[model samples]
Target: MLAPSQAHILVIDDTPEAIRPLLLALRGRHWRVSVATDARQGQQRAQLLAPDLILLDVRMPGMDGFALCRLLQASPRTRDIPVLFLTSAGAADERLEGLSQGGVDYIMKTCEPAELLARVQIHLQLARRRAAAVDDTPAPPLSPDEVVLRAAMRLIGQQLAELPPLEAIAARVGTHDKKLSAIFRRHLGMTVFAWVREERLRRGRELLADPLLSMQEIAGSVGFRSACNFTTAFRERMGVTPSQYRKGLQDGAAGKGTPAG
Candidate 1:
């Protein structure tokens, strides 16, 4: 359980000047504070810190707070942290969206410093209580299959460019190759290698949407050693070369009077 003074809060806001008052108020309470200026950085910080509370800006560049909140909910590590939406606009629809996206509270940036502090304290207390209850009645441990699946998936995602051999991956996740293959087939409807291939193509497709990345860079990123191999695989699965798919995307965007990039 987090004491009032021991609370660690993360403030995710792109506009530092606008959030200065909130920062000062939070600091004055003797609660530890961390800041992340963008949604990507905020997500990384949230997972790393697992702070007592999160004060997330509703609007951010690239991914908005709502999208970031959804990501947090998807992760097992940061899902329990309380998220308070910080906004200057205070629109009704925005508030509803924030709440629907799993925020615990919505606070106006223009609110009184004392009021903000009070709200922060309330949420922190609630988080502490929840933690205490969970401690009293602990959650069940993850099953072996679930643990292996999560670990293998995370490892593959982090090392797409140089994934280990199938036996090596299974060994790392504390299972043999045959058992791992069976697990993948049971849960993912495919063998481990097939899943990895699909994952690589999926990642490649996402990179293809970025106009700045060359085909070679995208190929290297998603585990293909050369652009030729990537193009062949992509064409076999997608019925078009990666370049053609990208051109289609650009063309579609151009037809709608929008820049593809």
Candidate 2:
């Protein structure tokens, strides 16, 4: 149980100077605040600080807020922390996208300080209440295989655009390729490369579901080197090209109902 004054907040933004007032306002409540300027640093800081709440910027170099949010959700250590998205863009699609990506709130960067602080306070209080409601008993520890899988998946997710070799990935997770292969085979029912292919297609499908994204942008985002390659692979896997699938999605949405993502 933490006191109100003991609550910690992490602010992940590329331009900290732009959000100086928000930082001051947060500290005014006597809460601990930490800042990270980019997605990688933000991830490291979140894991280290285990902050009660996270204020994430929508745009950043390397990885965007959505990607970082997904990474956090995939990790056991930091998944439960509430994330509030701060963006200069107030477009309906952007707000909907943020919420769909598991954000608790999508706040405009230009919002009044008082309103922002009020929202922050609400989430903080809710977090405390949820924590109190959880059982005190500790959950069972993860096995070695589970730990490796999580770490490997996290690494792969972060570097999807330029994934390292299998041996390198295995080494990073403190295991050799053979053991890592066995672990993936046993738990995921596939080889590491096979899983990577499936993950790329999965993420690509997700990007395709968004009507606002272009084919080239979607291709690059999910680690495909070129739109042509993405199309080829997508066609091979889904029995249709990315364009066809997206058209089907839009047509379905227009005719009947919301398409399943």
Assess each prediction's global lDDT (C-alpha) against the native: 0.83, 0.83
TM-score: model 2 vs. ground truth: 0.58
**Highest TM-score against the true fold, candidate:** 2
Tell me the lDDT of model 2 at 106. Answer: 95
Query: Given candidate 2, what's the lDDT at residue 143?
Result: 60
Which lDDT value does model 1 have at 93?
Answer: 94
lDDT at 246, model 1: 96
RMSD of 1: 14.7
Candidate 1 clashing pairs, residues 3+ apart or interchain: none
What's the lDDT of the predicted structure labeled candidate 1? Answer: 0.83
Q: How close is candidate 1 to the true structure, as a TM-score?
A: 0.54
Candidate 1 Cα outliers beyond 4 Å, as residue runs:
135-261
